[model samples]
Target: MIEEFVREKILNTYAKRTTKSKELWEAARKVIPGGAGSGFRYYEPYPIFLKRGSGSRVWDVDGNEYLDYCMSFGALIAGHAHPKIVEAVKEQLEKGSMYGIPHEKTAEYVKELLRRFTAMDMFRLTNSGTEGTMHALRLARAHTGKDKIVKIEGCYHGAHDYLLVSVFPPLSKAGPRWAPTLYVHGEGIPLLTVKNTLVAPYNDVEAMETLFRKHEGEIAALIMEPVPMNMGLVLPKQGYLKDIRKLTEEYNILLIFDEVKTGIRIAPGGACEYYGVDPDIVVLGKAIAGGFSAGAFGGKEDIFSNIYPLGHAVHAGTYNANPVAVTAGLTCLKHVMTTHAQSQMNDLGEDLASGVKAAVEDTGFEAQVPHIGPSGTVYFTDVEVVDYRTASTYDKKKNWEFWFSLLNHGVLTPPGLLEGGEQWLVSAAHQKETIEKALVITESALREIK
Candidate 1:
């Protein structure tokens, strides 16, 4: 890959700087498999340990500063350590951190979410997007009394047993170009589980209609990302989301919008607001708590009531509403609401996409930055990606070349060039000046890539 060849030369220039980061990795490897908390962090070189973040920057343990477009993989919209959020965290800490029962902050946080999604009658808080998607799927199955699910190919909801199928299937072994074989994204996710997942290409409503007919009563829910950003920021074609919502209602299959990445990043109401499609269930995470590890699922309250104690689906957590997260989330959501932050972030997103496209085309290379809401990516080819088949067809050699060149220029993108292309997130903190600087860096880097 491009990183290996570059590592030989790049490491020579930054040898000593990488040493301390290497040492941290060595120590971490003893306790954490992959030397990182999340498997996503296992990159070419050991990942850098972050010491702090403020605004649109992160300071590594080796004291290297970078313009962090990673944004905790699109988690931190308010940026690191916004003073208002810090004050809320401090105040909440003084009142005691973790209480086993419901707290006042939970009500306040829910209210903020309710304001954005007035259609939701109730919601349940969770610790991460993974849990949110997992539980949402469970609730979906319970409500509809079905055993299978339908998801757009290459779309990711979370790392659950059922949803973890076909996220990154190998193109060579993947059956037909149109009907790729269902393979689990990770090991130990049962083949039976994989069998239960119906794969349909994104933006293909006719294909989805065919699947709806094939497995009519077996499908519990149709879960997917509103923008399918994980497959490299492909926006839904006009009427795509609306068609799915309509079909799911017709078939009695629950419609779950996995807005974990798109939620609050697209708008206060998320992709639902952006596309004007109201799903029965919406799974939110990432930016939901302004970069903190927080997640939630809100729907028609009757569906949520299917969970145990009140219903049959079982979900529990030690830190479901831990004060630190709740306080951070409350502050972040409140700020997003007041500032009309999604509009600001969307403006930045458009500028970033436009500037990057202008820069890349000037290099005479077929590259473009595609975006929706506050997030997007620089695909190294001009191909309009809509589904996994198209995304896999892009020239990956040029893509990774651009990736490493950008890294050398001091811009940290998403870990691994594995997502077909890396995603770039625009934060409320990344003002006009920041976008311009990144554009300049992008232009110079594009020249270096070819």
Candidate 2:
């Protein structure tokens, strides 16, 4: 009864304040598939449509301003309309957006990426993270002459078919503890694609080895988010990443770290630098472009030698390194997201995560906030979220109530119904003041819930 009352109250407040957004959503549903550009952007009570954003804040179409924690799903590390990013985009805009040809900034951008990633010798740019992982997997298959791939159960590696298996699958159908069944994320994926993909539980080295021994030479590579953000930022157990790296090497399977979310956000070198575990290939996106659409996959020169004009594995895109996106990315890496900026954001992220954890405790909420660097998630689960099965045990109704209350209180989390799998990010633009503001709102919302 209390849960129902709290939920109704929050929903009423949201509906009252976001009438304009509601109307826009109603109109958008007619034209767009899910009333938003992406499936994740739409939610139960209609997603908020933002007009514009500045440092640390976004104004909704309904005129409500929020301390934007979504940060474009952790892509906007420099924050919304960051002055440096804006200037870079404007300057590149004058030069030209797309050239169907090579430009100077593309090489400059890759050089900076190579410096940061350290493990990657050569790099190729793509339009989105999906393309990066897609090409990286294809390169793996081509290089190893293997057909199958292994992916973490809950880790998401973009929209491609190869790595799309078992992301957020129902616990009932997810099979056993160590060995999980291959459950396709959605329909339209052919059985051949599903058959070629293998699933292993995250953080379980034994399970990973089990799959490796079971598949042996058939597996091309094992792709994973070193610290998976898709399942709401589950950190690898101590030595988990190192063990995986060693096992992959022993088994002759290439290790691909999908650092698309973690690349620039966790640290300058991302999980590779943070954890000191080097993989065969590093897939990067999100914060690398500082809000622009960009992705890159790179590793040892010999591996990437398979891509295009050089070798058999084909890779081509007209907008692969569109000058504008590269300019934004270049400026972000060299200027905005410097070592100091990364440290500051990490400090702020720690504060935000601490505050959220405190609020949960004070409000007697059974929840956990697992954070690293500039990203964290509020998992309303009693069980510690270590893997997909544990993460799925979270109370969805209570999470919905908590999310709605936070939204009503002017704090925007990631958009979705079951956002237990999503996270809140702190951008470089966020300072102590913005974090304090969010904490106040978070505490108040926590108190309002049961």
Candidate that would win on TM-score: 2
Model 2 C-alpha lDDT per residue in residues 1-450, reported as the tens digit of each score: 334424676788988999999899999999998699988887775788899999989999989999999888888989999888898799878877789988888899999999998988999999899999999999999999998999999989888887778998888999997999999889899888778899999999999998899999899999999998898889999999999999999999999999999998888999999999999999999989989999999989999889887789999998899998899999999999878888999999999999889988998988878999888888888898889888888777777777888889989888642463788889999999999999999999878877
Stretches > 4 Å off in candidate 1: 1-17, 417-421
Tell me the spans in candidate 2 whose CA falls farther than 4 Å from its real position. Answer: 1-6, 416-420
Winning candidate number (lDDT): 2
Tens digit of per-residue lDDT, candidate 1, span 43-150? 656767888899898888888877888888888888878888888888978998889888788988988888887668778899899999989988988888888988
Model 1: lDDT equals: 0.79
* Candidate no. 2 TM-score: 0.97
lDDT of 1 at 168: 74
| Model 1 TM | 0.95
Q: What residue pairs are clashing in model 2? A: none
Clashes of each: 1, 0
